[model samples]
Target: MSFGFFNIPAPVNEPVKEYRPGSPEREAVKQAIATFRSQEADIPMYIGNEEIRTNQKVRLAPPHDHQHTLGYFHEGTAEHVNKAINAALSAKDAWAALPWEHRANIFLKAADLLAGPYRARINAATMLGQSKNAYQAEIDSACELIDFLRFNAKYMAEIYAQQPNSASGVWNRLEYRPLEGFVFALTPFNFTAIAGNLPAAPAMLGNTIVWKPAYTQVLSANVFMEVLKEAGLPDGVINLIYVDGPVAGDIIFNHADFAGIHFTGSTKVFQTIWGEIGANIHKYKSYPRIVGETGGKDFVLVHETADADEVAVGLVRGAFEYQGQKCSAASRAYIPSNLWSAVESKVKQFLSEVKMGGVEDFTNFVNAVIDERAFKKISAYIDEAKKSDQVEIVAGGNYDGSKGYFIEPTVIKVQDPAYRTMCEEIFGPVLSVYVYEPSYFDSIIKTVDQTSEYALTGSIFAKDRYIIERVSKALENAAGNFYINDKPTGAVVGQQPFGGARASGTNDKAGSALNLYRWLSARTIKETYVPPRHFGYPFLEAE
Candidate 1:
């Protein structure tokens, strides 16, 4: 396997570790795992309505426990942005008129397509490009999205079609209709589900979409399109494009028919878009809907009586899963002073088993960051934390970018709760640890409220019901999706709608009825029946 950039060795023979449904693999298992490593996943640049495939140095998915050569994506131009928006606008009306049943059928077919031919390619891409372990890749590329499609379909059948009983004398009915415009779906890199499935939410409800996938996960997004097309989706019903944000925003905001933005990214960007829409509110024929799930400075509050083992496992997975790029990743862990030593010991024991390498190497625990910029940003933060007197680098602080964007899972003990590391959204593999006395729960909650600017997701670990309830109520503004005795990430689509208020997002839970309602506008239709032939309002004479 030669990449021309450097000399590469032949693929090694290693047994693929299989985990049954009930027994999930822990991140610690990467320590002793062995597997061949490769960095050859294809990167597809989707422009307008077509896929532009290239072998240019693009980031490859790293094996779960090993290192691999780095790759890069060729940048898209402004022309690509305009074309996709035009395609979506052109297809808006037709897609909007598509029957709910028909749309649901298309989505079902897409699910089948993904389950059949596209699964392997998607799995490989996820494992290689995103450095997801095989199990993790399967969860994102297979199980979760499949659940989304199936559940949303069922919701359409049960909830979306329910009819309200009307009065016998007055003949009237209410119909919920699709928003008559195009939806702009801007997705994140961490989840392929967001790239394809989020856009489908609006599309399934008779609205067309112009979706801009994250640059890092462009390959997976293209694969999703392939599945949809294979399912016989009408061309232009869902337009997939790969372009920079500013260019896409220009096209989305300037268009008279643009409906809304389904965004999952930074809060700064979300706020910027909100302001733009506000300024141009009067220009649009109809008010556009804005749904977003932005950055999260999620936390895990561990009570003194909490299970130390659970906290350790939860914290490790929360901080290092996908290198902590997920919106729901746990960035902070607040432990009670009495339990701090136990929690720290367990965390160290768990972290000790982590392996770091290329995407194809199955033994590697930490994978490469998406690109040089992300690597630089994370590395700079690590360097800054090293110099801070109020921060202590607890377990790991290694970084290697000579081959690719890679940073070790970092854990920092905050000397002061008000320190910059504890207060900000690092958005990397940086974990801040804080310890407080159990009696100071109220003050700790207040500190979380005052410090965190973003609140998308978080979790608390405690067996006591009263403590859990009190903490839950106290951290009301902490997040939209708060967990008890569990990790903040891995939200099930139907049961719990995922999003946050304040800086986190608009709190519109994707794949839920709440989200579906956003893509639709309600219309009231009234009809009157007369004994003979004349049926009209009092002002109109019988004819």
Candidate 2:
């Protein structure tokens, strides 16, 4: 007989390794990249334990070295999407019937695998395929993914442990059941961890998934599937596919069992998906859960009192790290007139020394943007800026796509605060700086708050406590992740649960228990030990 309740170990954030030159971690990832790059990987859709291959195929190549073919992935059609939905529904019963502890164990094992044996391969795959440097790859593919897996398992246990208080002669219980049907995980090209976590988080709560990774990210996506498989995840729990968004959305969104979609990508695409779901709301058996984290025109503001060197470092790192591709990257900055010269000098100095190229070179801090589309999009903005007398390119404005999608880390100092670069979400290494009068702090803060459509992330660098307090409260709604003297990017999983409001999709913090709750539908059960023989109430009888 089962007599005791189960508990998982308390979760903690995974430590990021500094993959310095000649370090073991550094060497391991390099070796893994070389070993895997030599062999071409063939990826096929997995539906109900069946590997489905189609004639339509797409080649997977590194963004940094586009001509080199890492592998090819078979494309799935609308029919394959239906099959994936069927596989999820078919596997729902037994998977849901299994104990929560057992489900958690699978994810926990996967985390351990990512932490140890599979770490280098996954990091290397991410580095090669996504054009992330070794450090960036390590953070995304190893540390963040492991944190999501382990922390989510512990969070699942915490959610299960919550129960309603029982009254006299009554037993109250709450059942945290998985969603009635299937989930769709549409992940972005930027973060391999986001891609892995989107599918795995739902599965940990007994929900099955139909995962579609960005076509460009399929190489690392395949490695993620391998780690999950080796960790003893059951077949059909998550069916990975490479399919067009329209075809996949048409099938999955209309299905009666369509449960939810875990998404991370552009705001335009997310709105399209949201509108379709609303149009087909009545077609589904249950109300589908819509959880997503989309684009951001994140910012950094420097007050007159801020240290020039500190502000410079924050702007340089926040706006250009990962080539400023992160949703939380600072694409815009507001610097007061008093600190402008000092901050500008330091920022330019840093950008001049920073190298931008292929990720294969360990010393290069800045790398290529994700693809040709991204390259063209960002380059267009730079060209537009060059034509405008309203803006000046202070540093790194040139771009070339002959070798890789490389755009020099650009800093655009705009005469107007309402410049297009400041308002628009340009997911590139282009930073728009607006210099404001030192005494106009209040009005400048207001302009900064109103300029961007996104409310994802922003930081304020100030030494004055009173001004810090004032700006903090004034621009509170401007960003979800607000920082003081820190870069807006590099949010730790357990510590800073990340997501934003307004145009930034649903703010259900991804790394926290709140996100896991979206995948679950709760049922409250109340049992009475003492039953009344008559239907009349006590108050009625007394009256």
Candidate 3:
């Protein structure tokens, strides 16, 4: 079937709802949480049209309230991973051949559904399942996921409309084709929006996907899957499974039909996957596209001229939000000797006011770390700092896992810039500060750039315009997403395309057309109006 060109609805970022006390949204979310807690759900793996439930049940619980049971998900074996791949491949042809507008409409419908009826449920799931506070859940599970679905659809239309120019007496056309095989979306636990976008992005571009979410995030992931299904996403277009990473990779990377991966997780895992793919290169029909956003040791740099209060606020919000679990969370800071006292006092005051507990309580700015494993890892770093003479614990170093995995938002002042905490990726609520002499600002900028292997996100706070410019230029490659007088976290979808390079990731900006292009393959078509014996050129006869 052929028709005139069509345009998708222009996308605008979804508005973040403030769940103030007594507001409808607050009441609704509270109700949703109660409803979810009342019943125990039995979840399954979505493979093709079948909801495959193996009797192997794994319990799910809120990170902040581990003693309470939420539900159980049926964990799958290697067979399910193979089945998921088969399902993705089987549906690929029909999905890719469907009119692009139809594909766009499915996701656009999903955006509306998420914004409306599904909003409270998804947000609640994130709050309970992933330990996000209500406001964080609103901005992440509701607004950001909605933005991803709507904007990706608009981007799809723009991508398809890009045609090559035609010359005199000839015609040229460019076709944007889906990848030849399936895509693997390996998502993480921190952001429900990211968990949704990882699979939804490639699937929106006509590629079928096998989505394996982090085990801890399964509760919200299931909610998102239901939304996609309700929005008329065809069965088998996206297959959700829960299996061990190595088991999935063993089959997927070695498969002939494996096409690409959209991944967000640790740097070590991504590197291992790449190595596996390279080892099995000859076993596949084509090179698989590997796109990943990995770890970050993000930083906050304070100049002597910067406002002390602003610097403190940035540090508190940037380093401690989401229990400092964000990949872009500011883990280290370089403070000038002149500003250190004021910044330290304000940061301590802010920490004193922060309450850590279950997500059900709206007043708790800080919540539990994801689980026992994360709790142990983050606490070990604090223990090491406590033992080290080179670092001073400024505030909040205590931790307890008696009821839940709660760790204080600890800050360390390190005598050495290259202290273990400063250079390492601690994916928890720990900020390490190194006070530099004001005259050594230039030298410190170089230190910031060289201290970490990651280049995900960082910020600079300064009053002087020239210092801002100078520091900005000097640390140009230090961060993928840079900020001025603001926190490094909370990147909006359209306003700031998010990603990083240099061990952090491939620098494929996720919120823009750049990320979409990775899921597509292009073909150029040309037709000549005048046909002649092309093999015999005019130069051969005339000369």
CA lDDT of each prediction against the hidden true structure: 0.74, 0.90, 0.94
Q: Is candidate 1 or candidate 2 better by lDDT?
A: 2
Superior candidate under lDDT, 2 versus 3: 3
lDDT string for model 1 (1-543, tens) is 322222112212112235443333323223212221323334455444566554334454343322444344545556766776677777777767766677788888777676655665666566655666666666677666766676666665655556666565556665777776788888887787777778888787777788887776766676787788888778777877666789778767877887888888888988999998888888787889999989888988888779988999999988888788888889988899888888899989988999876644556667776667788888888899899887889988889877667789999998788777777777778899998989987788778777788888889899999989998888898789999999888787766788888889889887677888788787766665644465666778666
- Model 3 stretches astray by more than 4 angstroms: 541-543
Task: Score candidate 1 by lDDT.
Answer: 0.74
* Count of residue pairs whose backbone atoms collide, per candidate: 24, 0, 0
Tens digit of lDDT per residue, candidate 3, span 1-543? 669889788899998889999999999999999998999988999999999899799999998889899999999999999999999999999999999989989999999999999999999999999999999999999999999999888888888988988989889998899999999999999999999999999999899999999999999999999999999999999999999889999999989999999999999999999999999999888789899999999999999999999999999999999999999999999999999999999999999999999999999999999999999999999999999999999999999998889999999999999999999999999999999999999999999999999999999999999999998999889899999999999999988999999999998988988999999999998999897767887779964
TM-score of each: 0.86, 0.98, 0.99
For model 3, how big is the CA root-mean-square deviation? 1.0
lDDT of model 3 at residue 97?
95
Model 2 deviation from native, Cα RMSD in Å: 1.1
Shift in Å, residue 83, candidate 2: 1.0
In model 1, state the lDDT of residue 53.
50
- Ten-residue stretch with the least lDDT total in model 2: 1-10
